[model samples]
Target: MSGEFDFTGQTAIVTGASKGLGRAYALWLATRGCAVVVSNRPAGDGSSSAQAVVEEIVAKGGRAVAHDGPVQTAEAAAAMVEIAATHFGAPDIFISNAGIQAFRPFSTVTLEEMRELLDINLWGCIVGLKAVWPAMVDKGYGRIVLTGSSAGLWGQKQSADYAASKGAMVGLARSVAIDVPKGTDIRVNVIAPAAYTPLSMGSIDPKWADYASPDHVAPVVGWLSSPLCQSSGGIYHAGAGNVRRAQILEGPVHRLAEGDIDTVMHALDRQPEWTSSFASGAEIMPEMVKASGS
Candidate 1:
């Protein structure tokens, strides 16, 4: 069993905190003594969902503030960070969970529709990272979690736009984690979660909500956001009380021979079941040399 973790002096910014997974993450961190900035878009009624989350946290004697705005724009992301700084301190934890989805055939997915999804899912994370990265860099300590999806990990039918937005996040998180400065405790990771949020539960049976609830996935995200976690560029899948680590691997290069191109084509086309994954980009040349049999 792991020892207890604490976030007594930490501050967090959680996007889409008005409901679903984002709300759960805000509450999870706030209850652990982490001051939280609950960010989300305003409701159709013009009331902020974040306000209610902030009130709930305050009722429990936890510190929280509400920032109501779309996370897609740099201005809105900056506002969230500014609110965090004003209310608690520099945000050390950021969960870019604000996203939207619409299931449709890939052929039917128009450019305008894809643009909207990318603006929120992909560009939202980009702006959020840009907003708080400077503070984390200067402090040399931070935890960043990007919300990804299994659609990106594998693939899903009739989810072209959603998958595209999420796949971009997985790539973005990996790149950011790899580029973090040396000697800094700052880490960035992605989580591909399968939670039954409003998007799923509203259309399905209510009983299954207990089995795939957003609450079930919140703790996994908390662990990723904890200072105790040493992982960067880690990809995780969490939901329904099951947590897993995901990896991207590669097979050795198949050099083609000119002497008997057709004879060797079949061998080159065959994929190895067991192949090593890259430790870093720098390993490519060495691996290539080794594969060359030189």
Candidate 2:
């Protein structure tokens, strides 16, 4: 089937484009007529994951350039954006997907490991976003897709560091969506992809493997990166050839004008209207204010 979305004359940057979901997203964007910037760390041979995607795009009559560098650094990310502009003009779409995952118990996670996880998974995206924000705002058009994971939404045992970093992505996207300069046509969205990328599914059941291919989640990323997507500051779940809206819902809260320790304990013990999640700050803040009479 033909894709409903087209990105003709647009430029896109896909980090971690050497393999898996990032690769899928880069190739899919190229097929849809986007001039892509495929970025990754500089491999020993001077080739990177970015180069692989660029080659595929070129072979398929699409325009693309490889940006081999460390996206985790501000200088490297800025350089990558500059290269993209030189090759195909300003990037209209940016996908921050560079990350690494390690399995270890919470007690075993070292401070260094935690810092590295947050640096690459969270700060890397922040660097890229800041690098591109200016031109995107100047042009008054931009689409940003941040990589989140199911682990970010639902806690995973033995994945404390990775989960924490991914959770931070949701907060970053939400802040950007609400705080971008007025009149800028920029939209930021998060995708909690449950794909069997290199970073995930090493120990998952083989029979269920088909449900988590990177290709299955590409369409959702494509749609979110398209000009037709009117929604912004939203989170979505994509996998198993299915794309659906994922939301945070607040449970009914109890109001207490003044509560002693016992009263607080009683309210907690009642366990009324329990829900799995809560809505965004936008939705819950008003209720919070009303509840507090603030």
The TM-score measured for candidate 1 stands at 0.87
Which structure among the candidates has the greatest lDDT? 1
In candidate 1, the residue pairs with backbone N, CA or C atoms under 3 Å apart (3 or more residues apart, or in different chains) clash, namely: none
Q: Where is model 1 poorest over a 10-residue stretch in terms of lDDT?
A: 274-283
Off by over 4 Å in 2: 1-3, 44-46, 206-209, 265-294
The digit string of per-residue lDDT tens for model 1 on 160-263 reads 77777888877898788888999899989998776778765543356556666788889999999997789888888777677778777666666665447776
Clashes of 1: 0
lDDT of 2 by residue, 1-294 (tens): 246777888999999898889999998899989999999998877657567678888999999999888878999999878998999999899999999999889898899988888899988999999999998998999999999866777666788888888888788999999987888778899998766676765744454555557888888899889887777888887766766676666545656755876786576543232121222211222333244343
Q: Report lDDT per candidate.
A: 0.82, 0.81
lDDT of 1 at 50: 83
